[model samples]
Target: MGRVSPPVLPAACEVLVVGAGPAGSACARTLAAAGHDVLLVDQHVFPRDKVCGDGLIPDAHAALRVLGVHDEVMDRALRAAHVRCVAPRGGHVDVPGTLAVLPRRDLDDIVCRAARAAGARFAAPWRFVAPLLDGERVVGARLRGDGIEHEVRARWVVLATGAAAPPLVAAGVCERRAPSSVALRGYLHHPELAATLRELQIVWHPRLSGGYGWIFPGPGGTFNVGVGLTASHASEEGGRASMREVNLRRMLDTFAAVHAPAAGLLARGELRGDWKGAPLRCSLGGARWSRPGLLVTGEAAGSTYAFTGEGIGKALETGLLTAAALAEGGDDAAVRARHEAALAGLKPRFELYEKAAHVNRLPWLADLVVWRARRSPRILRRMSAVLEERQNPGRLLSWRGMTKLMFE
Candidate 1:
């Protein structure tokens, strides 16, 4: 076999999207489909590994549909009818929703291919070095790859760089130097275990007070298993409070030791590659959304949720929002205003997820919520609504919610 050649980069494009993950791919697809020149670049090639739970909820399905890749993704995913939320005290509740699991290695490639098919020029192994600035405004970017450097000047730039601070800082849009949370994940191949585990399993235990663990069934006989921990929590006075230090690997081991299902899965299954970890920027407050002639979307703008660590959906949504903002003919100020407004509209939901982070701090809260959910279908339905983004998670996971559950 002969070595394949690298993708060619254009000297200039109408829109330059850095980071070809869900957010960048989504934005590139939207813009390319709209008949604009879009160049999508990433540091790694397609089929690259990403550390994630690989659970796709309703919102992710909706975003996939918008990109016209819902069926394609579903075809390769392991479908689940609902998620089994296991509480600290062994109490559990099944919350119904449209869910699936497709590893990031495959899921991200499908989305990126969709963008290319939509006419977005893609180049891989090209990492963003810095912004090409013109008097405090971003005009383009400088990319380094293959021991060489290239520059692309565009009318607008979109940063979809996920969770990494250096690129955001170089672009002058970083707000938080540290990630809001972190997660470690790996795959296990056990045909018997994968065949029987029908629904996604998320466990909360005292051993994982700073986080939770999940075992999601994936394509083939593989399972995506992991643990995620929050770095901070929302204070009573509405400020950020740091959590105790946690060793994620020890946390994962503890999860398996404490949760029966996870224990069985870990014991019997053959491990795939080594465990991979990544940082998460959650709660949508990490960086400024827009500046003159530029916009930041995806995890770089804190698109991941606090409690669930679900970001694929919101990243796609925000990327499309940026595309729409730029597609509309407007001045730099006008485009910035539109993008910022759209992001602002989604802030309340993220804030609610942050409030729900209390469950991570106090695992007993999960026990109480699950106990209530097991008895009341109303509470169960509301929990389902949370997955659908129709109900505020803060409302359902609060003291008020506990009182309501008691009376009901």
Candidate 2:
């Protein structure tokens, strides 16, 4: 999170986008391409390291295509045509597609460059402090950098600044509390594992509850390994916490030691990196996305899917939708209404994913689904299509499908 920007901040812009990550970058590119004077701000410079699984699955590929950067991204990635799902009960499923793997450092830089190429001005090493308001409406943002305060006015403000949601929280747009889903990951290098690893592998053990462990292979003998789980109390029913408070460092250590996929790596693999953990804000807490001239997107808007731990694709989707809404070009309230309507169209699928996340608590259910996925190509394809956005995510929760997977 480091970059140099001009000492003097611009006085105004047509659109002020906070955060230069996927959501902000994508939004800026779309707006700039449509000929808007855009200003994108962030605390870090381009190519900064971030905690992520970094798999741009089919859905992400689709988003990049819309942004006109698909070819650029795919060209640099170590392509994997499939994501291999492995259940603790010895069943596995392979969902094939165009999946790209790269570190978030490299990926974010690629998208950010595209944003600039589209003519969006970028200001980094500048942190967002709060929203500048005109009574109840947001008209600009207050920023702090180089040990001084600066104000940049704009017609509209978008908070894509992620989990902290500082602007959103400071202005009473989002809840002023931290999200509960915490996660950690790191890279490991094992010659044997690297030589043979071809697809992303997800391990669904009963212990992870709403989350899973993943071993994603990349080029050059490196593996992106991580573990994630929500606090049980954060579940849909909101009961007492069942999973104990975890020390991510130790949990990842133990998982790598005992979990089959990483166990063998203990002796042969080198500790190529240290553990990096962060709180994952993957659920919308009834966040008021827009109020007057202010709007929120990306993780701040809860775009991440806890069930699959995917945020980049969904974040990109939200960004494009915001750009589309803004392109209609109307009053603040009108544009917001349009954006909300478009996001609402996705509620059904997201709700189903929430239910599926709750259902993941039952090991037997995961095992049955995996067992069938192993034997049934159709079941595997259905699972794959959901992430690809080619089918309804809710289909996995259907009564008929459940009955068939368990008994048929």
Evaluated with lDDT, which candidate comes out highest?
1
The sequence of per-residue lDDT tens digits that candidate 2 reaches over residues 1-408 is 243554567999989999988989999999998899999988886678888888888778889999888888878777897888776675777888778788888888988999999999998878888889899888999998878789999999988887764566775787534564677888778767776777898777766656677888865777888887754235342432223466776667666654777666555677676778876666554367788887788878877775777888888988998888888898877899998887777666666666667545664666777778888888888887876777766566565668867776
TM-score of 1: 0.96
Instruction: Give per-residue CA lDDT, model 1, range 319-406, as digits (tens).
Output: 9998899889689999999999999999988988988888988999898899888988888999999999999887788888767777
Clashes of each: 0, 1
lDDT values of the candidates? Answer: 0.89, 0.77
Question: What lDDT, from 0 to 1, does candidate 2 have?
Answer: 0.77
Residue 362 lDDT in model 1? Answer: 90
Candidate number of the best TM-score? 1
Cα distance off (Å), candidate 2, residue 183: 1.2
